[model samples]
Target: MSRIGKKPVELPSGVTATVSGQTIEVKGPKGARSFTATDDVTIAVEENAVKVTPRGTSKRARQQWGMSRSMVENLVIGVTEGFKKELEITGVGYRANMQGNTLKLALGYSHDVDFEVPAGVTVTAPKQTEIVVEGTDQQLVGQVAANIREWRKPEPYKGKGIRYKGEYIFRKEGKKK
Candidate 1:
């Protein structure tokens, strides 16, 4: 049995969930999100909570049981509280600023990198070295932050690049001359 799957996801006040066939939809103050579970698991909303159960005693069914439960939990969190990812830029002259829906990044490149913000996700630069990605969809928020960090991943040598806030770069000893 899956530990996480055994726990039902509680629906907080002002939030609601509905199940249609294999799909579960959750709506809250932030937004509404849905997930379609595979046939290996079953989804249902009962008594102000969402539950997931494996279809049979199989490895795939057990795997999907836990995964489907977590997915439903994420949907509830996403609609209620949403998700956020923060990025920090380290290096001289490297900075980020939001210009409308475009993110202008100066990552030591000769030309500035303009990243067009996609729909549903909001990108903001609270400071020159800080970038904040916010959205109801956890996957999209993380992907956008990763894409932004890809432009200038933190190097182990000098650690000069963009990285997740509070992320530690493993330092490597330089030339021992």
Candidate 2:
């Protein structure tokens, strides 16, 4: 028996969930999101909560059991409160700015980096060194932030690059003179 899969996802007030075959759709004040589970697991909306169960006692089924439940829970949370990721830019002359849907990044390079924000996800530069990614989908929000950080990952030596907020870079001693 899966520990996490045993508990049902409770629907918050003003949030609703519906199951259509293998797909589960959740709607809340923020927005509506859905997910399709694999055949290894069964999904249903019972009472004011969503439940997930495995079809058989196979390894794949057990794996999908917990994953399916977590996915359903994400849908509910995503539709209700949404997801957000924050990035911090370090180093001199490194900054970020957002113009409409395009994000302009200056990371010690002569040419500015232009990142086009995709649909559904919103990127905002509240400050020159701060970037905030927000969206209804948790995966999309995290992926977008990761893509942005990929342009200038924080280095261990100087730690000059873009990184997630609260992330720590392991410093390495340099220059054995």
Candidate 3:
């Protein structure tokens, strides 16, 4: 038995879960998210918790059981508490600003890069070098952060570019004379 799959997922207040065929939909005050379970995995919603079970005893079934459980649990939590990702710009002229529903980034490039914020996702720049992305869906929030981060990945030589807050970048020293 899978340890994680065996544990029941507790349902928070104001959250409702419905299983339709192979898809499980979770709705809460924040928003709603759905995920489909694999063929070998099954999800059961009880009074106040969710249980996952594997149809057969096999390596693939075992793996899908745990993964499906975790995905469902994430959907529940995401709809309830939401998710956020923070990014920081590092460079002499690198900065980020939010205007309306767009994020403008200056990453030492000749032209500024503008990214349109998708509906249901909020982007805020507390500081010129810091950006915060908030959304009720975990997958959307993470994808938005990654798209912004791709604008300027950190360079090893100078450790300059966009990076997640508290992320460590290995710096390479300049060659000796």
Candidate 4:
């Protein structure tokens, strides 16, 4: 048995969970999130806890049982606590700014790249090279951050470009004479 699967998911106050067929929906103070479980996985929501079970003893079912449960549990936690992703610009002229609902990024490009902010997500630039993305959905927050970072990935030579906060960029040595 999976230790994570055996652990019961504790529901916080003001959060509601419902299991309908293969779909599990969790609503919290921040927002509501839902996910569909595989046929082999089953979920049961009680008064203040949620339980996950495998429908059969097959290996496939056992594998999916814990995975599905953990996913559901994360959805619940995500809706309640929300998620955040931070990015930092590492170049001299590289910077990020927000105007209204649009994000303006200057990453040494001739023209600035403007990204539209999606609903339920907030983008903030605490400093010229710092970006903070906040949202209730973990997937959306991470994807957006990744997309932004892709615009200008850090280069090894000068360690310049956009990168996640606390990310390490291995510096490369100069060419030999």
Q: Please give the CA lDDT of all the candidate structures.
A: 0.93, 0.93, 0.92, 0.90
| Candidate 3 segments whose C-alpha is farther than 4 A from its true place | none
| Candidate 1 segments exceeding 4 Å error | none
- Candidate 3: which pairs clash? none
Residue 162, model 3, lDDT: 91
lDDT of 4 by residue, 1-177 (tens): 777888779999999998899998999988899999999978899779989988888999889988987888888888888899999998888988899999999999899999998887899999988999999888889999998899999999999998899999999998999
RMSD of each: 0.8, 0.8, 1.3, 1.3
Expressed as tens digits, the lDDT of each residue in 54-168 for candidate 2 is 9999999999999999998898889888999999999999999998789999998879999999999989999999999999999999999999999999999999999999999
What TM-score would every model get versus the actual structure?
0.98, 0.97, 0.94, 0.94
Model 4: colliding residue pairs: none
- Candidate 3 vs candidate 4: the lDDT winner is 3
Candidate 3 TM-score to native: 0.94
- Score candidate 2 by TM-score against the native: 0.97
Name the TM-score of candidate 4: 0.94
Deviating ranges (above 4 Å) for candidate 4: none
- Tens digits of per-residue lDDT, candidate 3, 8-113, equal 8999999999998889999998888999998899888999998889999999999999999999999988898889999999999899999998999988889999
Clashes (backbone N, CA, C under 3 Å), per candidate, total: 0, 0, 0, 0
Better-scoring candidate (TM-score), 1 or 4 = 1
